[model samples]
Target: MPQVGSAHGGEPGLLTRVVEKVFRFVRLAEFEILFVLFFLIAFILFKDLMSRPQYNSIFVKKPDLDDRWP
Candidate 1:
């Protein structure tokens, strides 16, 4: 078996290298590209969160209508 931590082994495959290159290119792009990506994602998540109604306890029974003192 090849020795651990050797250059002959543990190298990323071609597809991985290509993906890394793509990520690097995007990372190196102008600030506008990153800003647009961030804003789009943030806007989508914020909209989704806002659209959901708050949860209510269905199992718990409401206090009796009578207003007797505790």
Candidate 2:
């Protein structure tokens, strides 16, 4: 994807400013921060998925479906 503001020699976009500030906080270089952000978002998504309830149903009492029909 093209840089928000840096596209076609234009000024940087809002996205660029936000990303630049994030990288500054993390003490990472501009280029490196993009990679880090990608991994961080992926990790957060994975962690969130793993934290959800694993069971679907609480309990279900159903009659046997065997061939015991009369």
Candidate 3:
């Protein structure tokens, strides 16, 4: 079978290979930075909502005390 990749036999040199690897790494790092920022914003919003008294009241369960607790 004819070698497909060898047709262009001009394989990238070391510098090209290194630069491609660096760019790939930087692309992944960019996603990681965005991921961190997204979660950071979400956490801040959650914290702010929880800090408000109204938000806390929404989750509070009122206890039945007619004759259930005494």
Off by over 4 Å in 1: 1-29, 55-70
**TM-score against truth, every candidate:** 0.37, 0.35, 0.50
**lDDT of all the models against the reference?**
0.77, 0.72, 0.84
Task: Give the alpha carbon lDDT tens digit for every residue of 1-70 in model 3.
Answer: 6656663466876788899999998897998988999999999999999999888878996676785664
The best-first sequence of candidates by lDDT reads 3, 1, 2
- Candidate order by TM-score, highest to lowest? 3, 1, 2
Better of 1 and 3 by TM-score: 3
Cα lDDT over the full model 3: 0.84
Which one wins by lDDT: 1 or 3? 3
| Per-residue lDDT value at 10 in model 2 | 67
lDDT per residue for candidate 1 within 1-70, as digits (tens), equals 8877556488887888999999898788869797899999999988786666552234345677786955
List residue ranges in candidate 2 displaced over 4 A.
1-28, 55-70
